[model samples]
Target chain A: MSEPILSIRHMVKRFGGLVAVNDVSLDINPGEVVALLGDNGAGKSTLIKCVSGVHLPDEGEIRFEGRPVSFPKPIDARSAGIETIYQDLALANNLDVPANIFLGREAKNRYLGGLVKTLNDKWMLGQAEQSLAALDIRFPSLTQPIESLSGGQRQAVAIARAIYWKARLMIMDEPTNNLGVPEQQKVLELIRRLRDQGVPVILITHTMPDVFAVADRIIVMHRGRKVTEKRTGETNASELVQYMVGALDDTRTSA
Target chain B: MTDSKAMAGFDEPALSAGKRAILLISRLWAWVFLALMIVFFVVAVGVFSSATFLSVRNSQNILVAIVPVLLLGLGQTFVIIAAGIDLSVGWVMSLASVLSAHAIRAAFNAGVPLFLSVVLGFVAGVGGAALVGLVNGLIIAKLKVPAFIVTLGTSFIVRGMSLLFSENTTVIGLPEGIRDYGNESLFYWVRGEGGGFYILDKPEVSGELLRSMDRILAWPVVITAVVVLVCLFLLKRTQFGRHTYAIGGNMQAALRTGIPVDRHIIKLYMLSASTAGVAGVLSTLRFTAGSAVIGDPLLLSSIAAVIIGGVSLFGGAGSIIGTVIGALIIAVLTTGLVMLNVPAFWQFIVVGAVVIIAVLIDQSRDLILGRRGRGT
Candidate 1:
């Protein structure tokens, strides 16, 4: 009933002659997880890329918090309170957890009337500890580089980064792809926590059970086109598979 | 609650005390290597020769020998940590040396003040090398040329430019004050004419007034120390340093975080060239002349020091202190070999072997840490 946090209308993104995302439109409301389901190369990634500022849409508009917005770079979208955690995790593996948490925007202590500035590492480490703890995530050592952490812990760090930055909308691309079973469950739990915090999440995933378990709405895309949109309770995995494979289409018109 | 336990299960157990000790030792392996080398040299020199290698004079000699390589390694540390290399650094230093020598000579001939002429020479030297670094950065960052290729090509070009600029000869005829400034000591312990030891600010060079004087710290060493301290601060305490590691660690991640990757790369190369410039000027000051080929043999030594210091060639992890130890290792090996009357050719063979050993140790440490990191 309330206004959607992000609205995409008639979005189109093309790579050369290939239309990767074709006239796809979706709305994400606050406190809800929208599972963007699709097969490999099925425009789901491209659609989210448009909103996340990875690719500019060739057609259509994106509105965030009721204002028409265009992000020229990923940083712009981030500054606008939309954080995208790429499938690769977007972490500097050589750096510690706190450094990853405050990658670009680091806290600093300035001396000599701001002439000399050093990273306020103590402050950042404390804040990172609090944020991770808030999400019930614990690390044996916060100073260990991200590469030493397990896959699930890296995901927690990424999610904590989004939360620390106060992102209103979280976009995760295949967050559970390379994770183990337990790690996958941890990530899904984190998604639920994001939703509970009133941050809308657009989850691009291929896992059916993940969609069923956490997503409130499911939008299935096939061949760069949206096939169906359904409430999680309304659609079973079999029905979603039919829509995903283009066997069922709610938007297609019979010729 | 169950998920939290699952997460805990995924983490590798806290390192055992023995393993933690190994980790600490491995992390400080470069320093340990340096200390071990000094002990070996002291014992070897004492047993095989009449001189003591551990004396203050020999230590000063080692530190002085470390200056050029350490300066170059300091810059290489940044580049290597950023997953880049600057082959042009040696030649860039040569070019700066020639330029500064010429500028100083010309300024002195033009009746410029001694202090201003020295400053002018420094500006000319650092500015010239920095320009080369800028070009190197732009081509590598913007045109996407590989850093190794770009620096190699620039190295050849700068080598030719230095020879051309200096007319294929060492520039000489520097003012007398320049040599004095270069050799001056911060403190001098003098056996004075009154049969008493006195600490003087300036060494009384006259034979009548001074029996023997021990120079506590020379200007070159002081200058090098100041440069080291500043670089230490820059690399450890600043955002620029954090971004340098991030860029090297995962450049894509750095870009996604909105870091100015290209700009930072450009600055990094410039910083590297600037250090080389400093080394060049110091060499000119030490010798009171600048030769186009002075930095020629130092290229490999500087890189050897960097790798020996535990800086991963793959980038994203290294420290300035490690590079300093690495430099000391090289300097000590060279000086100790000479003290033992070893054939000069053996120095190269031994250093080359040490480099291989250092890299092997580094790789093994990574394997150990990496295996543990995977929670296996």
Candidate 2:
């Protein structure tokens, strides 16, 4: 790891009297693949929302590249090279692949009234194709609407889009949950490829096999606390579950 | 515009999990706009000039004659796009016009620069509307009041502001340059018997039986052209335009994607109202009167044009082209009805019918298209 991409200290989030995320500290270095595993109502979504700038933390400090940062809007997060692929992916089904890839950012010619007044489809389509190809996606065509792609193909396209836009940190919330078995495998391969390409990824999932398969490090959340942080090779599934259920804290002696 | 990745299969779990944005240009509304154009032209020509009604000059005159309303229509596009409405836009126009005339008179007499005063008056009109729009946006976005209630209230407030200035009196003095914009043509003027001076403008077509309409060219037509072209650029080419559509389409999804939804809506309201103010200035310049009362009839007319232009009341699916065409239709219908000596009250009846019919057409098309397949 060349540098720490994300560093959080004493991060806390509250919804009225409800403590959704308690004082928790975590860090992810460049090119690292960290998995955040938790059961339902374990504050996974709330924590994700805080990180993705959907909700502000009540008390906390978030640092990107050692500089203090707070995002009031998701655009601030995205512009700073942090891209979150939401559970629903947030892809506009009505937009074509190239259009979707360039959503909110259509390339334009600087010179005004240049008779060829249109979106830079040539550049966008080329990039979309290259991204899908780099991620080994088997989508039908760049011209097809994203809705036409299978679930896994869509996930691949999403990962490809994030990586294409030069995201140093990709936050994927259950990229494989709705995907077919083969699609899950495709996403697994995409995750490993992202890490190998020096793009750090934050994989939030409850799937034990997924955690064991690609995560270099694991952070288990139980009732809004980071109960465990261990290397994938340093722990087994049962110990991770105990940490997730809040029965234990950071002790990987079982593995 | 920002949420490109919220894509899910129509039946996928992702679809059920979070709301998504639909980015299609809305084919149903486009078709409805086309139908309105056909109906408007047919009715106007049939009811008025049997032979010269659908001629090129007549159509062009119709297009040019309605340029002021078309400008006002541009403002309506923004307000409606932001899911807000401005009933005060008409009064804003009248106020802007009277102020411009009063400024011109003051500048012409005091040895001060009339150019600066004209600019100042222009700014006053836009600034006044913007002030009201900001309040409208603040009340709607911050206070959680419905857009209708806030704007409806502010409309009266703005109208009262204009009344305070006008005092039931039309401003008397207007500079030559301003009036030239409304009355003069570079190549020609439609001169009548005994050297009567008039441009080939609105009052002509509805008055005399024209052997040819091409001979009657008005400056408003030129104004309409420049306005439509600029509006198209703003709506389709710029970042602000994209933001406007995104806010209208699905605001929640836009927010998750990091769009500044509130600021965007506020800017839209300002843009909409300010454009109406500009229209008022032009109308004042054209009529050569600082009449504090302008566009009283235009409140309904401005909104009708936007709706009939194919913009959905739900927002996010319209073009400047559609709006211009819609404005032309309204002006032509009015002129044609007057040509038939139809009572002005009946004109209101006709306009009301046109509005209801347009909405119904839009709704029915939505039904027909809704039953059909979904494509990007």
Candidate 3:
């Protein structure tokens, strides 16, 4: 991989003396899908939070674009071209899909010599229509609020927000956990499409189908440590489970 | 985009922006109810008593009496919109009156320029009230305490301060200019049309009013109207206004959207107190005498008018015009009862019942509308 897009080195985190993530490290390369796989208490979410700047690692270094960086807040992380699409999808239900897309960063027009500013509704709606189309998200009306949309459609808007911002790295936590078969396939297709467009994604999930369907590399964690790392093409789902349970390591594999 | 469609509901483009300019004004219906009540009271007075039931002088007197209370209601709207209540309004009024009275008397007795003491009194009253408001905001925002408890505590504190300073006494003397600011006619370009007849009494602002209508509007009423309009514009049009609604609606949702939630809420609390100070100043100037007990009775009515105006007790919903109408409804009801010679004790009962009924209606509308949305 040509100079990792995002690199983590010995990342550690604790919550009231409970070592949630103890000295873990991973690298996400440009145009590559890295799967951070773990079971319930494997510290996958904690590591993702550290990378997304939601929590400051207790002891570790996070390098973005090959330079060591520290972000005090999530907005700082976003401004640095790192965006996280959370599982809950924090889109305002009362607002339309377009409105949800350009919510905080609203386009404004200065009508009276910059003394007065107004929401540029026409411009934002047009852009929302385009972004929704580019993502292949079909909604009945461009003006319908997100609450009126199906679960898949709502997820589409959240993904569209991540993509439209043009983030260099996107981290999705459990992107397909609640999705049915068709929706899961749709999301998988969307992930491959995102990779083809040159944005690296960190998919955090325990579903082997999701891992096999998209990941270029799989990193398994148990307790608070990274136990096994392998290229996805060379690995099998059953063997990955052994590493997750600490019955196997990266060095040894048993049938 | 057409006028009827725009008025019927909020269409895409607002056509009423220029010609009619009415958005969020469904609140004005209550004000119409207030006007009707006034007319009914006038009729009742004419039929039952020998005293002239209605005349230009009595009509204007009723308006003047209601003006200060309306100011208080307008100020309270800001606080309520921020999901807060200001129970300190009555105390704030008393403080303003005492401070202004003392300042006027001291400066007048101490042989200083008359205007200087009046200004000093205003500054003292408004400034003290604002300081307490700031404290209220700081406490509520920083400690994350509920607003109702904090304001309630502060109300007793300020009330105690007012009593201690006044010693339950009344300050009698006040400057002419300060008093006239609230009471004076200022101008009456025409007296009246020499009447050809005097029959059944009704507000005859036709030629009779037209003959005397050339005068500039009273400054107090003008001031109150200006404050209401500015507040309406700010709450309905500005970014801060939108933030206020968002915070009141759901603080967590607002914060996630990157709105500076705590600061905005605190500023809202302070704004409420500051406007209460303005009303207090107006009240002090109107009454002339600085009674230690000034505006004690206004608390319940001021709040009643605000809630009745269609301002949601649940917060996140309400309008300025609604508050004005609510205030007017309360005002007209009180005045109408007195004009019809209803006994003082029955007047409170009547007003209290009206307040309760209005609040119940407002509460039910909110309950229905809230369940309609997807739990915003």
Candidate 4:
């Protein structure tokens, strides 16, 4: 097999007296969907937060594209081609669709040889329309603010933003949560599309059906430790539940 | 199955004609209200009083009155849209006024050229206010202190500094040229002695000239217009304006998207203070003196204009044009009240009522539109 795209070695994170993520390691390869499953307080979010630069790891090295990397902030991680779709969507809800698509990285028209620059609204709007069209998403009006859009449309905008910036690795934290049944299906389709386009996705979710549907490999965490890792075909829902509940453990000495 | 059926038709429907009309009206409500107020005053003053409220002279008076309030509102527009407030703006203006007066006087007394002294005054005034803005920005942005507390504290500090600097007295003795520049009209159309028309430029302001001055647009009015146009362009066409809305709309989203949030906040405060500085210099020029108390009462009026203009106090959604109409509304209301021989205190009560009315209209607009149909 080809080399892994992202490799975490003995990752450790602490919140004062609590070891939120304890000495866990994992590898993700290109063009694959990896579902990170965990119960409440299982440190799933904490681990991803470290890679996305929301939190710095106390101990561990993150290698992206075969080079050791450290992200001082979310922007640094994004600049290095890591885009994270946070649970809250990380969108400026008061802004219009095109504006959100190019929020921090706005396109500009320069005058006086770049001394004066204005937002290239027309260009951004056209590009946003094309990208959404590429994703087979439709909006009644692109000029309306994000708050006016449906939850599914907002999710589509976020995914389009990552794609527009050419993100190498997409991290989605519960993208289908709080969405309607159809919206959930739409988001899953987008994830499969991302995988098809050779952009690896790390999907953190609690939905067992979602894991089986889209994830090629499932990694379960229990009590801040990796309890088991299995291919989609090798694991059943009931067996995976045992690992999630700590009834089974591959890393345990007795087991 | 029902959910899937509904999902297939989930695309938002187009706004109906009636809904579109409501959206347009709500968006332009400030301008509509300003027009209505003007017409009401014109009719009331004509019916109940001997004076006309719609004359060119009265209109000029209203425009002149709008200068300071509009300037203050202009800066406040940016701050409010960025989900911040700078209470220090009023005293910042006073401080700028005092500093400029001192700078101009000192330069003139030292035999500096009159023109250069005036320029120095401009520098000192705007620069001083900008420094206060810098301090305000640093404390609020870096320390993560609430804007209300920081600006309120700075307002007191600035007010005290102004009084201390001016020695609790007005700074006077500016060169006569400054006042002349302030009063000069861009075009003066005087009725000629023989009933012909004579248009003069930079005509001297005298009792005789004033008597025959059929029409006049003063330099201050023109200057204010230029400033307004520039601000409108800055807030609409530039990247800075877009980022201001983003920061206010969702600061966390802005940070995650890689915006330099703190630096932008500092720049916003500075922009606000510098506009206050501009108002100060204009005030000093108009009166040929600077008092630490000039901007004391204007702060609330400026904020009132912004709110009345329909810029949401919640931030991220407002316009320069709205604030302009808001200022006009207040000025017209005050001028009309005075014309009707209302008590001086009535102006405050009336303005407060108008502010409440404006907010209520905004809220009603939102309710009427509902969540799915709100406009930008």
Candidate 5:
């Protein structure tokens, strides 16, 4: 790997002494899909939250582009080129596709910036159309609100938002949860597209097929600690499952 | 491109024509209903009452009378769109009116100039109401109290305050200059000697048939129009309006997305109360009196106008123009009934019935459109 985009060392997070993430370390490389595999309460979410700025780690060091960094809030993480697509999608159903995509960071009119500034709807609509088109995602209309869209379309819009914002590192938590079979396939394709475009992705999932399909490497966390890490090319699905349940003692396996 | 097209085909299934029609109709239903009501009134009033039922003077009066209701409705629209309601608007208006009235009286008694006293009175009145709005916003945003309950409780307390200050007596006989300012006509239409009408001309050519033409734009009408236009611009063109809708649509989604939800909501309540204060100032100017009970009747009617205007009680789906039409409908209904010699008691019944019918239509439209329970 030329240089890892993000590196974490000795990360620790706790909730009232629960120790959700204890002494975890990981590295994510450019164009890499890292599948964070773990059972519920295995601290997979806590570790990701720490990186995404949802929770401040009790103790740890996080580096981006080989520089130490801290994200005090979600916005800080977002401004640092990190985007998270939570399981709920965090979309306003009442707002249209373009509006939801530009909810927080809206594009303002060039001449009409600040104090009296108004939204540049035309610019935003065009950008949204282009972004969705880039991802091969089509909606009935850009003006169609998220609530009116199908499940697959909603997911596509969410992913398009992350891509349109030029996210260097994207964290997707259960992106396929509650989606139908075809919708799940679309999300999987989206992840592959991201990787092909040289963007790094952190996918948290319990589904083995998803991990084997897109992940270049798998990191299994158990009981608030990273128990094993493996290269997908070297390990089979059965062996990854054994590591996940702690049946195997190997902490690291090279392809 | 070809691969993307194939994927698009798999992702976006086309909506059937039946579904399209339902969507279109559900969206335009409010406009259609409002248009139909106006048409029905025009025809019925023309046939049953005097031809002057559609006269300009009557229309101007309706416009003037609906100003306060329209202002209240506009503010309520914002609050409701943010998934909240302002039950204290009417009482706030009343309190503001009393405050300004006292300020004006004190100034005049203290030997101040009429013009300066009027200006100072307005400032005091609006400022007092703005303070009340701040309190309301702080309590609701910080305490996390449900808006419906908080505003309801505040309504009674504010009403009592207004009564206590005014001593339950109407302050009448305001300065003639202020009264004139309120009653000033933007312009008027006078009929010619042979019966041809003149536009915005003084009533120089007097005749039995000569009367003020329809569309006599009054000062109050002008003020209402300006206020409405400003609010429309705010709601449609500004980020504040978008944030209001987002917060109303789904507060959790808004908060998670980094929107300052509490602060935005506080500002919305303040806007609602401030508008109410403006209405109070206008009321004092028009009535030339301050009474604690003046705003009582406005409370229910303004809410009714908002509902009739197609602003969903569910929030995040309404417009200022819709509320304007809704206010007009109420004013027209009341005026038409009076012209038809309908009893005051019967007018109340009719207005109440119309409000209930509007809500029923809204519900049926949602059910037929197959979008029930989809607001969030």
Candidate 6:
């Protein structure tokens, strides 16, 4: 089998005395959609944070493409092609569409790049329009501030930004959060598109229907430890619920 | 089936006509108010004949009079836009004026060229204010101190330093060149043949035009215009400007985006202080003296102008152009009242009432917009 795109080995993350992620390991390969399912404080968020470099594991190691790596900051993870779409979407409400899409990494004028470099609005605007159009995302106006956009449009912008950056692995925390039924469907479709385009996605969500709709595999974490991993087609939602509640301890099982 | 439906089409929801109108009014309300006020003064002066408020001379006077306030307000706009305030700007200006005046005087006595002395004085003034701003920024940005308390405390400390340095006396006798630059009109009006004024660059006009009509242009006003232009560019056209809005809108989001929030804030405070320093130099040049209390009244005026300019005290919105107009409104009100023989005390009451009214309007606009769409 080809090497997993991201590999974690016996990772442990603790906040003071409380172990938030205790000796958990996972591997994610290309073109795979992995859904992280658990109740609140089930170590799902903690594990995702550790992978995306928002939190460093207290023990164990993380390897990307078979090489051990450490990310001290979120930027470090981003530079390594791991984009985490945090809850709230982490967007500046005052900025326009193109500005938000190209916030930290703005396109600069090439000729004036060395001297008096300014934002290349023309290029950014064109690219932003094109990206949204390709994703079938329609917004009111690119010049309008993101603050005025509906919740679904805002989520679309965040997803488009991650995809535009060509993230090899995307970590989304509750992508369907606060979304209505239609918006939730749009997000699920976005995730499937990411997977079909050969990008691996790790989605942390509570909705069972969302997991069944798109995710190819489901990993359930209970009390800071991974209890089971199952193929979406092979296992039912009830069986997955048992693992989430710590009712089942099918440890060391490969999907 | 759901995937196909979700992926197939996205219908763009258009903004309703009423919501669009509300947004338009909210954005342009400040400018409209300014224009109406100007019209009111023009009509009042034209009918009452109390003073020549409609003439170019009165306009020049208003421009020059509000230069310092405008400058300070320009700087305060940045601080406020970044969700911070700099209460010490007025005192910082005073300190800069005293320090620069001393430097210029000392250099002139030591046989340095008048121009060099003036430059040295200006640099010293800016440096002093920059130091004060740095302390403010460091405490507010790095140590996480509230900008209000930090700047308020620094204002007192800076005022004390100004007093201590000048030994409780107003520093006088600035270099002749500096004074001339401040007082001299770039363009002046002379008496014309038809009993009106003819604008002339030189005072060498013969016959009836020789006597001064009124200054058409003043150096202080020119400096203020340049400052306004530069600030407009900084706020509207630069990456720093974008970051300022970002930080002000949501600091946590700015941090997650990897913006050096503290550094941007520090730079903002420093810029605010530097503008205050420039205002100080202009003040000294205009008055030919630097007093410890020269900036006392300016504190209230600058804050009032910024708030009145539509720059939300809550931050993340506003423009330098709005601030310029806001400063002009206050200046015009003060001058217009004086021309009408209204007592200075009553002018204060009027301005206070106007500020409260402006804030109420701003708050209501936000509320109305919130009901229409996502409330920023």
Each model's lDDT comes to 0.87, 0.70, 0.72, 0.87, 0.81, 0.84
Error of 4 at B269 (Å): 1.0
Lowest lDDT 10-residue stretch of candidate 1 chain A: A246-255
Question: What lDDT tens digits, residue by residue, belong to model 3 across residues A36-105?
Answer: 9999999999888887778998898999999999988887888888988887666655456665676566
lDDT of 6 by residue, A1-255 (tens): 689999999999999889999999999999999999999999999998888888989999999978999999888999899999977788877778898888767787644557656678889999998988777777668898776676677788888888888789999988888878877887788788789888899999888999999999899999999998888999998898989888887774543
lDDT of 6 by residue, B181-272 (tens): 67777676665564444343545555555554667778778877888988997888777788888887777778877888999999999999
lDDT tens digits by residue: candidate 5, B1-376:
1353464433464366777687677667667766776677778878887655666677788888898899889888899888889999999999888888888878877889987887887797778888777778888999999888888888899898998988775766567677755675667555544544444453444446544344367666787798899889888878888888888787877887788888888889888988888788778877777767777779789999988887778877778888988888888888877877778888789878878877787676567545525433
Models 1 onward score TM values of 0.95, 0.74, 0.74, 0.94, 0.91, 0.94
Evaluate model 1 with DockQ and give the value: 0.45
- Residue pairs with colliding backbones in model 6 are none
Can you list the residue pairs that collide in candidate 4? none
Write the residue-wise lDDT of candidate 2 on A6-45 in tens digits: 9989889988888889888989998889999999988878
Please give, for residues B90-181, the per-residue lDDT of candidate 4 as tens digits: 99999999999999889989999988987898899999999999999999999999999999999999999999998775998888778865
Candidate 6 chain B minimal-lDDT segment of 10 residues: B367-376
Model 4 TM = 0.94
- lDDT by residue (tens digit), candidate 2, B1-376: 1221222112243322112222233334544545575576567657666644565555656666686788888878867765567776777777677676666677766766666766666676667667767777778777878788877888787777777787574776666666666655533333344233344443344344333223444565665577677778878776566556655654554565556677877777777777777777667667776666686667788888888777767765567877776786678777666655678888778777877877776666455334222211
Most DockQ-accurate candidate:
6
**lDDT by residue (tens digit), candidate 5, A150-203:** 666777888888898889999999888877876787778888888889999999
User: Individual DockQ of the candidates?
Assistant: 0.45, 0.18, 0.16, 0.45, 0.46, 0.50
Ranking 1 against 4 by DockQ, winner: 1
Q: Write the per-residue lDDT of candidate 4 for residues A92-176, one digit (tens) a residue.
A: 8779999999998899999999998988999999999998777667778998877766777788899999998999999999999
